[model samples]
Target: MKKRRIDIVPLTDQALALLEAIKPYSGHREYVFPADRNPRTHCNSLTTNMALTRMGLEGRLVSHGMRSMASTTLNEHG
Candidate 1:
């Protein structure tokens, strides 16, 4: 996990729909989740964690945990 890698995540219909919904707001940007102060850069890595914390899931889940869960679910189903 230490090594940097590119992952090709398959988009589910729901995910695609969400992306479409956000297109008007972010589609023009280079990064969908661009930095607030600087659109040229990607958002802070802790953004997701911060959001989860705001939603009262700080101890229950972390951003990377979500990715791991998704990967597990996909592999198990496939």
Candidate 2:
């Protein structure tokens, strides 16, 4: 058996603004970051990892680490 859970992350004004800025590029598509080969599908799961790697953060941090840090910071502030 597995446990399932849902998390609601509140977006900040800046985040909303960024989304609005990106709307023109992706609003017509189903995914905000659509696959390069298939607009109907989302980007690959490793997309964030690849980005981190490109930024020379391969060993220092990963996508989940970024999420965990954000969660921790938000929880601490709230």
Candidate 3:
């Protein structure tokens, strides 16, 4: 495996905070999500999504989804 370059530096403190919250384990080389606690089964952010869905906000869009939703709006209005 080879190290890959990240194109842009984290622009905001919030962005850095999120990255720090999901620290990667050197062994796995991936972000540590809640579902990854049990290595026997592989799970991603779906666990988080399922939790949110239970709150009646399922499919209401998330942080990443919001970014996608807002980028175009911001670009258009800015």
Candidate 4:
């Protein structure tokens, strides 16, 4: 699974630039992948939650920590 996939409809130059920046593919898919395969293959809710608990024990981040960071960052330029 991939966290992100290419969308060709909104064919802006910026989107094309981002794809080139991350990765390049040599071929095309005959069938579109289902939505469930979006995230990294090995990352699931249980694994992420366990890691978050450990992070919290180490006085690091809690489950909702990233939400605020993303909201703040988006609000700045949103």
Candidate 5:
């Protein structure tokens, strides 16, 4: 399959601020979602589950559910 080039728009002020704050929390790494062993690598499923638990959404919202919520909210606004 051929890869298509995608353009990324500039981040909003809120998004940039969130990135700045979360960078320190993630040991100054570029990726905020850190792996279990290395807080600099991409987090795996276990890490995601742990994050959900820490956020008090383990029982209430699964990953897919969260995506669905985002999709629904965006659709509703549009």
Candidate 6:
């Protein structure tokens, strides 16, 4: 195996706390967003929907829109 450098993205305190709280509920997985009523797999659609709903942008923005915004913001900062 070849050694390679990996860049680390820093998480905020709140993010860390949320992950810590979800740790026990995850059983033995590293995913923070597991499928509802089942911890075996991730539910991408459900996660996106719930997130947009909570942000009050359910009808206004989709997951792709959020990704575009994030990319634009990072590019602007960089």
Clash count list over all predictions: 0, 0, 0, 0, 0, 0
- In the range 1-78, model 2's lDDT, one tens digit per residue, is 134666668999999898878977874687889877787898887989999999999899999999999999989999
Residue-level lDDT tens digits of model 6 in 1-78: 235767677998998898888898777575676777676877676689687889899789888888899999989999
Error of 3 at 19 (Å): 3.0
lDDT of candidate model 4 versus the reference: 0.53
Q: Candidates ranked by TM-score, best first?
A: 1, 2, 5, 6, 3, 4
Candidate 5 per-residue lDDT over residues 1-78, each given as its tens digit: 235767667998998999888886788776777775876587775665677889998788777777789999989999
For residue 66, model 5's alpha carbon misses the true position, in angstroms, by 0.7
What lDDT does the true structure give each of the candidates? 0.86, 0.86, 0.62, 0.53, 0.77, 0.80
- Over 4 Å off, model 5: 1-9, 50-60
lDDT of 3 by residue, 35-64 (tens): 456654546656656667787886675656
True-vs-predicted CA distance for residue 22, candidate 4, Å: 3.9
- Return the candidate ranking by lDDT, descending: 1, 2, 6, 5, 3, 4
Residue-wise lDDT of candidate 4 within 1-78, one digit each (tens)?
Answer: 345876546657986786655542312332222123543232344554567777674357654666788789979996
- Any residue pairs clashing in model 6, and if so which? none
Instruction: Give the lowest summed-lDDT range of ten residues in model 2.
Output: 1-10
lDDT of 3 at 54: 81
> In candidate 4, where is summed lDDT lowest over 10 consecutive residues?
26-35
**1-78: candidate 1 lDDT, tens digit per residue:** 235777677999999898878877775687789877787888887999999999999899999999999999999999
Cα lDDT for residue 48, model 3? 56
